[model samples]
Target: MASKHDIPLTGSSVNIVKKCGPALNDILNSKFGCGATFSGVDFERDLSIAHQKSSYVGPDRRFGVTLHSGVEVSVWKADLTNLSVDAVVNAANTDLQHVGGLAWALSKAGGPQIQRDSDDHIRKNGPLLTGEAIISAPGKLPCKNIIHAVGPQLTDPSYISSAEPFLEKAINSILDRVKTNKLNTVAIPAISSGLFNYPLPQCANTIVKTVKRYYEGVFFNIGHIPKEILLVNHDDLTVQEMERACREILAPHLAVPNSQTTARKTRSAAKTSTPTVQIANVCLTLMKGRIEDQPTDVIVNTASPDLKLSTGEISKALLQKAGPEIQNAIKNTPPKGYVIRTPSYKLPCKEVYHTRCTDRGAHGAEKVLWKSVSDCLWLTAASFYKSIAFPAIGTGNLKFTRKESARILLDAVNQFAQNSTQKMNVYFVIFPSDHGTFQAFEEQMKWLQAPRGPTPEASEKRDPFPNTRTPPPQISLTGPSIESLFEADKWLGHLFKSSGTIEIYNNFIQHFSHNDYVQLSRLQQNGVSVEEFFTAGHACITLNGPSDEVAVAALQVEAMLCSVQKDFVAEEEGEMLLLSSAGNNVPFERKRVDRSTQEFKDKAAAFHKQGLRISKLDKVENSTLQLLFNLKKNQLQCHATEEMFQRVPAQFCEMVSHVGFHAEFAPPEDPAYGEGIYFASTAKKAMEVWKGKREEYLYFVEAEVLTGSSVPGRRGLFLPPALGTEPLRVHDSVSGGSDISVIFSGYQALPKYIITCQK
Candidate 1:
């Protein structure tokens, strides 16, 4: 049996391997892989001892010991060092190629050897199961080893749903490896945000909460392992947001080191005979100096106001207090003024300059404040030509929003360079948890790389939806029925564009099934027919007999369906139109399912239990649709299964093939299942409507035959009975005695508000 120390404080230990039981040889290999190269007896006990010694001695808390001191208790305010660790955990997927993210940066720093070793190991081991760990040498890194832990696969339960579990596994595995290796320090970056699709703030909370919990009570179980944990700071929005959240969550325990000794030494070492001047406000200091001769260095004094208080409020007050320091620096300068030459901050020879600024109120004002500060910095630069990089002007106590500050600063720098002879490269000298500011700065820089402008030679570019390969599908029909449907919101866009139906289906299962929301889709691809798509489930439809018997018959049919209803909701129209409008003026109300209502809440719960789904019609405007399914095998949800997809009917298949979608679904295997498939068509609009929702207007599809006989639009499936389904399909040609009626039904609406796809 596993020892008690192996259990994390969160409850049970994570399942490291999902598919296979370890054999004797497997154990031997694992031991060898662990590099138990030491020549000695009593290996097991020795290893256990070593593991115990390396575990972190996190902050004391009711929740439990944590992986890092501040990660759990939020006791520290500084960014943790990255190089000081036995191993660094890189949150990675099955494919380990370093793209644009923290993974990519780590890969770059670690060098090609790291990637080579990773690829080789993965080749030998295949894809890593969620919560599994594999160790390899750290290559160029300062750390001895790098433990690549695959969190959760983004295939099912969506990345969001599986995020917490994956994080739990990652935290435990890291702790276990740290203990076994007898390493005292470990650095970890924010996991699961980029491409993994988990929300930033939630991911942060999970990491901090889980690691803290692990360090608390669980350490004793691990033979009283005492260690240090460092949560490496990141330069991204995710990390900044995490820091903010962590600060709030860890408020009770947050404490500042009495750095009197350190500060005194720092001050003494850099001692200048000149008098030390301090400021209590950034705005007053920045405004103190003449715009023409701003101080070269703006020092922000973070000293407390001689009172006992919390860290957050103190950090917040620091920048404001530093403003007077800038004014003093300016006053102490020689009588001779620095030559002010340009609008940009760069001057002739003086290298760096710093200034204080503030975050007074809303984001709009902050932008303008930072811009002016940068303007002065540029003027200083122009006076000196080439100056050293300086800390940002207002980020300290002014409390300027990071994103806005970065944008304003970068913009000012760019504008100053327009005509100035002196150019200055600026650095923000950002404090810890300023990743959001860095991200904004980086984004602005990246945007500068692209060419700007429009031209007559760009006629091909005039069309917004260019036909690169197969253009995204479009719906040509007009009128009421085309206006209603639900698109699965922003997060699921990648899933819909995925190459194959199975992949899309799997993605949906992973992302939405565990959540309260419904995952809706229109056509399988750009051109796939609705019939082929609907055939995947057992679709039940209710009809309202002739108009003469409409009320009674419709009521009877609805009652019958209601009796068998395990979970459901009523809707007046199809969601296809809503899907199409997602890119345009898609009405918001019809698109989103109101979760506050008891009916929706109940239906949501029912959808979870029945292995089925529900679509309701409260009031039909001009159209409606509904469906019920028995999801026998969640193929799209589970790991690859041997079960085959049920072969659809011949006619349906023919229709699908005729209006075929251009798509692919090649699994990364010998006989790859389904991977990459693209469907092309002008019929995409119909597909969009099929998967979306329509609230404001009716979507209608009118048709006329060769004899000029006009028929009512059949697309308004959600219309009210008062509109009369018969009137929807009526023929304009006054024939001798032909009676016409339209086929209409209610729809199952998906949540539109939460998942709207931005145009």
Candidate 2:
């Protein structure tokens, strides 16, 4: 047992004070009775605290070191940063700029200056040795300084031995500098996990433990000096897996304190409400009990989708309890199906709906479970039913973690029950054998047992509309025609903003290049500050103009209007409202068009008049688009995708054309990095194309190093700003823009009836 008098530092800052080295160690060890053992050095005589205020470290103290005499341990604490700090540890090789793990990413993100800085440092320091530390400029990083902490160099025979300790030393050296410079935050990439073959989990554990040990005593005082560390991981899975592991690791530390021991024990006892599950033969013994006699609706936890109407299976034990008729019905039914005998002799209610939980192990089953639960609740409520019984779902199937499943079911039930004004009760039935399930229920009951927050009636009784004291006032907006174009831009912008790659369907997006803008003078002349002109809620229709002409005009003016609207959004910031297109849905092709039809003939005649004659149109409509496209020499035939065909009617067919423009954004390259020669030209082209388009279309930019390039034999990726009729082809043969068809914007915007010679 440790004595209270012997403990110098008692709060959360213990580990933090220990990482700063001798100064913090001596005072804490002496005062706290911590018998820390320092390797090779006599810490008792050498250690001294430079600054001590009742063992309270300031929040601005980003790093610290302390020793605990009681435990005989030395700990180091340093703040981790989200942004770059004094030194960002890099996993680098002698050839620093070349592709590897952290090195490649750092090089890419930092731009070309990083390589230059690295080269300059190496020239002065010679080649860096494993465990060696040096300082350099951050290049393009947010940090002003860069601490190049080298790990062991890899060779054929693994240099694993020197790698581990070097990592530790590198970290220590950085922390040492942090204290010296009084710098607060630093971001750390998972060093040596890539190409070098360091195990990720082990590396993660080491980094976390080192940070934990160092900052044991000093974290609370680190003001703007971030004590919080954000681990940057490129891999999404790696981040999630590591996060889950960390959560589990921290769980033991956050366990309930002893103050609630007695209460916990009581709750634990209450949790064991059910006894062992007993299986008995099918039999029904009904006693006299009115339907209204039951206190509330009984909800059985189930693993099936349909609960209310489906005749779900019942246990042999339950069958014996329910007797012959119910038992017979249950035996023949599928699992989780519910059979309600209205006005039962044993309980209250006009009907009984049986439901089940979803099976955890069932592949592709969670969606089914969610859908089933929602369906049952919705169906039951449709009949104006007040309450129903439900069971613990997923307990038997183990589909969900106990606490998680309990919360989900209870939330769903509570939400459903509240949609009615009548009284509602959700009775959770527990089986004797399911101890874990029972524990979850008991835990929920505590919150359920509370006197409800703010309003108890809302908690106990269902109310269709809790805040129904006053009717919601109506709101409306009216704006100039410019607002309609703003809506179109917003709608298209959202579609393009979608995650992953976006592809435009059919000739709808291809036919027109829209540049929607109100002239700067027109905007001011109209007395519209761009706010009133582009407000989202305002529905502006071209009341007297031709719909097609108006739409085309809106498309052309959208960019200028969006630019204006964006400024307003920035100015208003918090006050901006949402705007959606009234009736326009994404136009997707629904059916394959007959290329030989009158419409096709008319289009062919129009194009022929323009000197762009089709050679062939593919009869088959493959891929997602039901488009009928034909190749003309330097010209292209365009049609709608399946989605567009289905969404847009034939009346809107005129909206489909052979010309349009779209744009994409990317990070501009640094000249200092020496144009990644192989990819530079393509990237330039891509930038040009993206900047030129403002309408709906599929666009792509790829940079690749082609064979036999004049600049260097070295390889690099290339970017080609190209438009495609479909998703970008990943096949290597089509390197860069080989597979993409670059539709000429100027040519697409040309009128269809202009006959001219092919120059």
lDDT (Cα, tens digit) per residue for candidate 1, span 1-759: 100011111101011111111111122112111100100111111111000111112321112223333323322222222364577777766656543244545666677787788778778878777776667787777677787766653433355664688777877787778777776666666666544545656777777777666766465566435355655543323434555555555553643332453344443332221111111001011111122133333222221222111233322333234333433443343321221121122322222232323345745445445445544544443233323333344454556555445545554454444323222333333433444444444444433322242322343232222332431222111111111111111111222222322111211111221111110111112232211111221132222222222222222222222222211111111233342232222122222346668856664464335232323212111111111100111211222212111111111221111111111111111111112211111112222222323322211111111112323332212322232356664332111112222211111111111111111
Residue 135, model 1: Cα distance from true site in angstroms: 2.1
> Candidate 1: misplaced stretches above 4 Å?
1-82, 153-159, 224-226, 236-251, 255-759
- The numbered model that scores best in lDDT is 2
The TM-score of predicted model 1 comes to 0.32
Q: How accurate is candidate 1 locally (lDDT)?
A: 0.34
lDDT of each: 0.34, 0.35
Minimum summed lDDT over a 10-residue window in model 1 is located at 43-52
Q: After superposition, how far is residue 439 of candidate 2 from its true place, in Å?
A: 7.7
RMSD of candidates 1 onward, in order: 26.8, 26.7
Q: Estimate candidate 2's RMSD in Å.
A: 26.7
